[model samples]
Target: LESILANLSAGVLVFDRRFVLRTVNEGALTILADDFSGLLGEAPENWPRQLALGEAIRGAFAEHESSEWQEQIELEHTDGLPQILLLRGTQLPAGSHGGYVVVFDDVTRLIAAQRSAAWGEVARRLAHEIKNPLTPIQLSAERLQMKLADRVSGSDAEMLSRSTQTIIRQVEAMKRMVNDFSDYARLPAPELTAVDLNALISEVLGLYETSRATIALKLAAKLPPVCGDATQLRQIIHNLLRNAEDAQESVDSPSIEIRTRLADNLAEMIVTDHGPGFPPEIMARVLEPYVTTKARGTGLGLAIVKKIVDEHQGRIRINNRQPAGGGVVSIALPLASLPTRGHRVSQLPTEA
Candidate 1:
């Protein structure tokens, strides 16, 4: 039984009727992402509130007559990423001395996959529906402006010109929004190859030398190459840098830091800004499409970045920096095993 519990991916915890934790499996420790030394043999009330496990155990103890209780709870981790856990609790059979058993599994990735797919479908439909009329709208406004150019005089003429120009400009903005939707919906698969991550970052940073934000780099001396498409990877860097700059818009001396390191056979890159961190309301769903805090932001930048990183089989984490108020975005990609011949870098147009 112990071997089976140890090997199972689902976490299991046993507690007596008094609600003191008695047995916890290896899976529980890993899923919780913390040390349980002081938690063992402790009552639920005494356990940390952040774990949220205590609530599940208490509920089970309160309703021992019920068949089972199940719930999904979000746990904030030390690393800043919140984990979604599916927990189930049940009362142990009366014959074996009354106790309760709580079981849980990490379902963060599964939920994220579902949300991404749903948003992608929405983006596809929006692109198809909204993009068709944009060109005609812009053209009609231009035609009206030209035809009325000679008919109206003085202030009336100015009014006509202004109205038409406003129409044209708004149409152009809508067109841009539709394009973003299309890009998010139909992002291409990354062409995997052995490419130096540090080199690519340096190349992207060159474009931002004159940016309003003071950019700094702490790239590792000899970071290994990662398997990714150069063009798509460049987009990731561009988007992050743009976001960092936007975050520090109100600061007297805006600053951005970019760092790279190798860990656990993965190439990790981190971008941080010295600005007010993500607002509390939207931090959890910041990666979701159209969830943005910027007044002029389409909110698709991070969503598209998430999609690209997903295509490369990479991982991303967003959190606010401690002590100093700012935001941190971390991305980790699997290191390429072998070097590629004739590595190619593709240049593609970037959005503002």
Candidate 2:
């Protein structure tokens, strides 16, 4: 069973008396971005995880009553990319050479999604609380200026009026930022239903698409109707597509692709483009609200998409389309179960 699972695309590692790998699965090798060729017949401590994994494993073993250790530890690869893994191990019985079992399940995407969602929440709450008093304050300042215009001397009136105007301008700026927060937080819960995902993509493409950027659709046929909120899902699709458009503005050939498919009892939505993909530096933080590559972007777009998908009890994924080319990202939603709402008579986003 372990051997079969190891052959799968999830990483697995085994350690022996000297902390050398006795076995490693294909998935683990892929994640390491290296085959076990040079790593085989080496001490577990000597393996790629020598410093971090070795110390963690040794500590867990010594501290445990039994030879089992289970934890979520973060490891940074030589590429400087971080891999979050849930590490689990168990000691074989006596005479088993004190060997241990280990597994590494990558949770980088999960953690990114969580961080994005959290920041979005914080921004939303801040905006909601600030908006209430802002409107009245601005109104009162304006009214005071109007009433005092004729009562005060010209010199004093001019200074007081300018001060009030400055206050009003600053308050408006603060309101706008709060509005961004409100937008991030106010995506109402999705009301999911059975609907044609391809149609949804087509409708959204025709609606919010920009003449400034080329939009491509390569939707799959023979797929099952997706179970999700048409309106909210469309919003998600709209936001992601717009984001792709914004990313492509920097490329000479800006093209966007939208695709749909079903896999492992889940429905999938993939958006690809012929532009620069996510920045290598901030890929880990891109989903977090206020984390944007654009000079003027609010950076809450992806964060909103993530929250909507999570509300539907589905999963989403983002990746650079292989071949080291342009931008390519994906979103996946599980459709094994039926949704709980009626068809939505809805609309899409305006042109960007």
Which numbered prediction scores highest in lDDT against the true structure?
1
Q: Per-residue alpha-carbon lDDT of model 2 for 1-352, expressed as tens digits?
A: 8768756766787777666777888887777666667567786466564467667766777788465678887777655557787777787776866777777777777787677667766877798789899999999999989998889987899998998899899999999888878877787766767767888888877875445777777778866776677888888887887888887776777778788887766688888877767777777666667778788888878877777888877776666766665666677775634344444212211110
* Model 1: worst 10 consecutive residues (lDDT sum): 343-352
Model 2 has how many clashing residue pairs? 3
Per-residue lDDT over 1-352 for candidate 1, one digit per residue giving the tens place of the 0 to 100 score? 9999999899999888776889989998898876688888998878874346686568655775647888788887656667898988888777788888889999988998999999999999999999898889889989998998999899999999999999999988888888989899999888877789999999998898799988889999889888888899999999998888898989999999999999876899999999998887798799999998889999999998999999888899888898888989999987776334334212211210
Give the range where candidate 2 is weakest over 10 consecutive residues by summed lDDT: 343-352
Off by over 4 Å in 1: 49-51, 60-65, 135-168, 338-352
Clashing pairs in 1: none
What TM-score, over all chains together, does every model reach?
0.83, 0.70
For model 2, the superposed segments whose C-alpha errors exceed 4 Å read 1-41, 48-73, 76-81, 86-117, 151-162, 208-210, 335-352
For residue 302, model 1's alpha carbon misses the true position, in angstroms, by: 1.7
